[model samples]
Structure formats: C-alpha cells, structure tokens
Target: MTRETPAGDLTLANLTKTFGRRTAVDDLSLTIPQSSFFALLGASGCGKTTTLRMIAGLETPTSGQVLLGDRDIARLRPYRRPVNTVFQSYALFPHLDVFENVAFGLRRRGIRSVGGQVRQMLSLVQLDGYERRRPAQLSGGEQQRVALARALINHPQVLLLDEPLGALDLTLRRQMQVELKRLQAEVGITFVHVTHDQEEAMTMADTVAVMNAGRIEQLGAPADIYEFPATAFVARFLGQSNLIAGDVTGGSGDDLLVTAQGARFSVPAGRSRTDRGPVFLGVRPEKLHLATAALRVPAGHQHLDGTITDASYLGVSTQYLLRTAGGVELSVFVANSGDQQRFAIGERAVAYWNPRHAFLLGRRAETPDPTAPVAGEPVGVSA
Candidate 1:
C-alpha cells in the first residue's frame, strides 16, 4: 500500500547537548529535506548518535529547537512526536511472533484491525511467510527486516536508523544496504541514518554529513566529498588520500603551481580550497599511477620520483607504497588489467597523475593523529 506523506523539511536550529562539562553536541543547525535519504557519518563519540537522539525526542537539547515544518517538537514527549527509531539491537519483543511484533504500534493506538497493515509490511520487507516466527527463530537479516517493518507500519514523519545493520555479517549487511534504500524509496519519507561505516554511508545515503568533535566537518554528495574534501580531517576520513604538503609558488593559466619536497606540481585553481601560502595537495590513491623511472611521464601529468617501498597484490588491484628522497610517502592504486607493468618492492619508480585530479586543502585546526587507522585500508575481511 502506497501512502503519501505531507512534505515538510526537518530543521535543527542551533541545537546543543551537554553532559556535565562535556559537550556532546555543539551548537549545530541543519535542514534535511522531506523524502530524502540523509546520513550522519562519524567515528564513535563524534555526536552523530546524540544528534539523532535529539531529533527522535529521546534526548533533549540543552538549547535550540527541533522543528518539523513550522512546529517546534523540542519539548514534546517521545510518544507525542511523529518519529520512530530503529536501533542496532532491533528491540523486537522476544515472546511475540513476527506478526504481533509488527502490529504492536497499531494495537497500542486503539486500532483493532491490524491484519491488512501487518501483511502489507511483511511483504514489503520480503518476510511474507515468516509472520509466525519469533525473533529468536529468525536470522540476523530477518530480524532486521522485522524491525524495519515495525517502524514503517507507524507511517512516521521521519525514520531514524542508528547503525541498524551493524549486527549482520558482511554479506547480509551489504544486501540489507540495498534493501534499506529500496524501502525508503517506496515509502517516500525522510530517512536519517546514523552510522560509523564510511562505505555504508556512501552507498546508502543521498547526502552524507561527516561529523567531528560534535560538529559537521563536511556535508555533500558522497562523490563530491570524496573527490574534493573541504578539510584535512575530511580528506583522511572519507578515504585514502595521498596528501603532499606544499607551498603555492604561482599560477599558470587555470592551474596553481605548488612546490612540495622540491618537486613541482600543478593543481587546478577551481579544485583548490585555498590559494595562498602553504597548503596540502591531495589526490586519491586510485588516481595516481606508478611507472618505472626510465619511462617518460606524459606532458600534462605531475610527476614525482620515488622508490617502491611496499606492494600488495589483491585480486582486483595492486596497492603500492612509494617513498621519495625528501621522505614523503605516497600511496598508489592500480587496477589489475592484464598486460599492465608490474613493479617489485625496492624498485625506483615515478608516481604521476593529471593535475586536474589533485585538490588543495588548508591546514586543519588539529593535526591528524599519526596512529589512527586510515579509512579504506585493505584488511583480511569478507567481501
């Protein structure tokens, strides 16, 4: 059954939350469009969860308002607000069957006839025949779907998902990502998801907000943020970036020339976040190509001479670590197309890429911790 919801954006105006002297959420303001899929992405303790809680009426803000359209719901009780939340635990009743669990909300609202709604929701989640199963009898993915169906049956103004897929295995989690997007499209209501997984955010959300230190560091389409990060923290958090600390020397037509480690490189002026003084020239690992030093680099490419310090051959691509004479390490990723040149560890090579692929970033307020794990680093995990 298709239901049309009244269109109204969810707006947070100067919202803040504090625990004792520690501020969990700073003075933050944002507008999430109606019927759009939005993601709050960050590491643990970054306040993404707290922000979601405030919107769901589970946590009260120390200041500011939570507005749905023109009405302020900041002071409303959780049951009074037209919002529903699905947590990592699913939180389904252990003694109730799938049908009863999903029908609980409608029953509580004094609706005696919930058969049709429960059946439709079960089919929507692809659990039509599992209506009698208990939560303990279902698989992790099935339990997740039941939880989602229960939330959607209420016809919420906004659906809040807090790491809802965290408990599933890799394959099940990937499958559920697709299912969640499909369900959102069919229901056509605002979906605000909070997650720490970068890939999950990139794959599921229409817009992603990267949070740091109780504030949004960057917000945009996944591709835009990944390609042109606004801050050093964003550059490193979204994915692997080969950031080269450089000084802007001058401009050449449409590009800004930068000198890093005595090597000259060109960055497109439009792609740069800063134009003067010192900056970090950033490029993704996959954008860089490695070649033997004897081979000449193409005319339009920026080149750096380095020695291959490490090489890892994954099935689909090869990752190489290169160290230059000036002691700068660069990561390069090459697709494993047949007949491509292969370099061995300790071999001298040239790392080159088109200048258009590079972006410039200003220094961050706090330098990134050296020991923190880099996003997108390959590990021995399931596909």
Candidate 2:
C-alpha cells in the first residue's frame, strides 16, 4: 500500500451526529496525531462508535468538519474518504480465502497485478502461510488480522476500528491488543480504536478519550487520565475509585485540607479540581494501605479509622472493604508478599495513603457509585 501524501493529523472539529430526536455524538472535536494509536473509550451508548462512524463517513455529521491535515472530507462518501473501517464482525467473505480477502481492496481498484501486494500484506499481518485458508477455517484472531490486512491494503490515512476485538475471548483479546499496537507503530498511520474495555484502551492506545452522554468527558494518556481524572465519571468509569465526599476546609502549604466522614485529609493543591466548596476526595484502591494495631500509620500520611467489613484473599492481593466511623465505606488493596499481614472481618483497622496519591473532584457526577459491589464483590477489585 502506498500514499501520494504523507499521513498527517486527523482532526474532527465540532463533529456531531443524531438519530431523530436523540443525539449520538454531540459536537465532538479532537485531533489524532499522525501514526498515533488513539482510542475512543466509553460504555455502550456513550457515542464512541457513532463518533468513529462519522469519521469513516459511515454516518453523516449533523454539523462539523472532518479534516485530514487541512483538507475537509466531512461530506465525502464513505468510499471517497481516505479512511477504512474494521468492524467487530471482521466482515470477511465466507467463500474467500485469506489471500483473496486481503487482496479484495486492491483488486476492486482494478489492480491486475496484485500477487506481490497480497503476499506482502499477508506477511505484514503474519498470515503469509495461511493464504489458502478460508475464513471458516481460520481462528477468530486470524480472521481479524485478515480484515486488518484488507483495510491496510488501501493505505488509508486513518483506520477506524469499531470494537474490532469484541469477538475474541479474553486471552485472544489481550493478544490482539498487543498486535494492534505493534501494527499501528509499524504502519505509521493514524489508528482510531473504539471500545468500552478500559484495559484494552489503556493497553493499546497512546491516548484515550473517555466519553459520556454523547460527549468526551476527558482525554489524555492512559496513565495521566488514570492518575488524574478530570471528572467523577472519568474517575469511576476508567477504573475502580474510592471516592470520599468532602468539603475543602482550607489550604496548608502546597496541600488543600479536606474534611470528609469525620476524617481530615490533605490533597495536593495541584491535584485538587477545586480548592473550595464541596468536593470528592478520590484515590485508587491500590494506593491505600491497610494497617492494624501492629502496624503504624506512616508520618505525614492521611489516615482513616475504619473496621474491616469484608476481606477476600485473591491470590496476588487481598481486597478489603472498610467502613469508617462516619459510615463512609472505602476499599483497600494490599499486595500479598508472602509474609504480609492479613486482617479479618470485624477487625479494627486504618487505611492510610500519601497525600500526593489523592486527587480532588468537584461534587460527584450522576454516574453509578463505583465502590458499590457488583455480584459479591467490587468490579476490578480482584486480581
């Protein structure tokens, strides 16, 4: 595959889409850097897929511009746009073998001599030896690669992946995540992936945009967004967060003092979303350490006195639910390092963490409480 113009940033300016009275994508705008792996991450119906469709020309934007470099292609037909989409279904022709499936794009353009290109594409996807195998004979992962090879053969400036790994099982999904990232780096083309899986977006994307209710709630590198979420929804949706409702009391040096659930804590001024009024003190479960009477709280660490309400030993770590005196519940994760102490249910304990590990968010959003247990345990609390 070859391109006359070098791949540049793919920009969407105030893009939107609607279905009758409901807005699917609401004034979405973002720039995907050249050769970057970008992910639109959100739960189903958050408009991630709709945003990708708009970029691929599968859905017309109600208002906005789709710019590849400086060229606007918002109104272009799907086939005319310099973009290709790989859907979750793979969409490979059942009767076509791997070779024909990958070469389908090139052959459609009336390229008579496609043997070399077909073989090269197959090799690029590590399917060179399986060209003769039909879609029915290949594994789920194999068919996905075939679809990728087919799309890449067109040399599109942008590749849209709509839950492309949704069909694979857990193991295969993780494997494909690595392969997709590697392929994006090797091809040097903007790859826009859409998925609801937090781990998938974090593992494969250079940047992740968390969407909610038809708009992007937050966008940044995985670690940045994970460590410092811009919104309460982003904090809970991206991963499990222990959010303690609090009121900013005052400022002390570089930390803002917060009072929550009869406990006073310090949040880094730079990390606090707001320095005054009602706020939520947020911290990752893994960042909090549990200490019993035998263990002492580290100096300068914020501590919350609570009773262990639940404890589950999950091989590599232990998940504990602690309920504070003021009825505020928190989750703590302690890594199992052989001789680590284990606390029993009903045991008095204290959860402590460094002030720098805490972040502040404006009053909670209308999303479901993340610490609420799903089934018998909190989501992502286990190994």
Q: Which has the greatest lDDT? A: 1
Error of 2 at 260 (Å): 0.6
Estimate every model's Cα lDDT from 0 to 1: 0.89, 0.87
* Residue range 1-383, candidate 2, lDDT tens digits: 45436557899899988899999988888898888899999999999988888888878899999999898999999999989999999999999888889889888999989989888888889986998898999999999999999999988889999999999999999999999998888888889999999999999999999999899899899999999999878988888788888789999999899988877788989998888988889989999999895577889888888889888787888988898887767878899998888899899999999888999998844544444556865444521
Clashing residue pairs in candidate 1 (N, C-alpha, C atoms within 3 angstroms): none
Candidate 1 overall lDDT versus native: 0.89
Off by over 4 Å in 1: 364-383
Compute the lDDT for candidate 2.
0.87
TM of each candidate vs. truth: 0.94, 0.94
lDDT by residue for model 1 over 100-194, one digit each (tens)?
A: 99999999999999999999999999999988999999999999999999999999989999999999999999999999999999889899999
Q: Which residue segments of model 2 deviate by more than 4 Å?
A: 1-4, 364-383
